[model samples]
Target: MAEQVKLFGVWGSPFVRRVEIALKMKGVEYEFIEEDLTNKSPLLLKYNPVHKKIPVLLHNGKPICESVVIIEYIDETWKGTPILPADPYDRAMARFWAKFIDEKCLPALWKACWSKDEEQEKAMEEACELLKTLEAQLKGNKFFGGDNIGLVDIVANFIGFWVEVLLEATGSTDLLTDEKFPMLCKWKHAYVNCPVIKENLPPKEKLLAFFRARQQPTSGPKYE
Candidate 1:
């Protein structure tokens, strides 16, 4: 029997995009179910009962929650282009950096984009410092995944694309100026311009409109 695969996600969510990219990279065929986060679908709730979050991959009736875990599942289950490295140590390092991007970089970056005044300043500094740490990781690599996109690159979708969008929508910060982090800026330009990645990304206008509607009063990111 052919594999049954379904991906449940929210539009414009970088986390969801991560899984989508992985699936496409592996040449896996799957159905995409767009979830309404405000009023989530019962299937989404059922599939991900714990966090009730998105980017859940349903494979052969089994649900995989969390983007990173789902991605690892995709890598192991499919036998096409590799997402994680082949060497055990390299794979472990990739997982480490993916964890850092999620647990450290994302929260600070999201907070920096949304928070204001002193709070924004603090968040921005923390985010920049974290980004600088990530920057150092890219000394010789064109991507965190070396020459091609991989786990860390996928995990960092938010920083590479959404940071600029958030900054534009808020019109409140210049946190990621090219001069401040030239290497990252260059990486961002290159990563998003790749044909495969560029085609899969949510339309910038739609994203900007969505985020513009979502601008908050300094309470900060919904989860971060």
Candidate 2:
């Protein structure tokens, strides 16, 4: 019997897009179920009750939650293109960078864009610091995984795409300009232009409008 695959995700979520990119890289077919996060569907809750989040991957009735975990699952379960590095140490490093992007860089960037006063200033500094670290890690490589995209590249999609959109929507201070982080900016262009990611990424104007709506005082900047 064929495997059944379904993805529960929202339109404007970087986390969800990363999973979709990974699936495309692996040539895996799936049903994309767009979710209204404010009013999540019962299936989403049933599959990911712990967080009640979108980007849940239901594969053959077994549900996997969290974007990074789901992408790892996609890599392990499918045999097409490799997502994670082959060497154990490289794989570990990729996973490490992925975690860093989520735990450190993304939070810092988000706060930098949405917060105000001292908090925003501090966040901007931290975000720049973290991005510089990533720039050095790039070490003049074409991509995080060398020539082709890999786990770290995929997981760092937020840095490549969402941060710019959020900053533009908020009309906030820009930290990702070419002058600040040239190598990273180049990497961003390359990563997003890759056929798989380009096809899967949401339209930038639409995403910007969605983010602009989120900035309303009533709605706040947090993604549901």
The candidate that achieves the highest TM-score relative to the unseen native structure: 1
Tens digits of per-residue lDDT for model 2, 163-205: 8888898888888999999999999999989888899888999
Model 1: CA > 4 A from native: 215-224
- Please report, as a residue range, the 10-residue window in candidate 1 with the lowest summed lDDT: 215-224
Pull out the clashing pairs in model 1.
Answer: none
Q: Compute the lDDT of residue 208 as modeled in candidate 2.
A: 88
TM-score of each: 0.95, 0.94
Error of 2 at 138 (Å): 0.8
List lDDT for all candidates, in order: 0.87, 0.87
Backbone collision count in every prediction?
0, 0
List model 1 lDDT by residue over 1-224, tens digit each: 99999999877889999999999999999999988877889999899999998889999999999999999999999999899999999999999999999889988887888887998889889999999999989886788888998899888889888888989998767877789988888888889988778878999999999889974845433421
TM-score of 2: 0.94
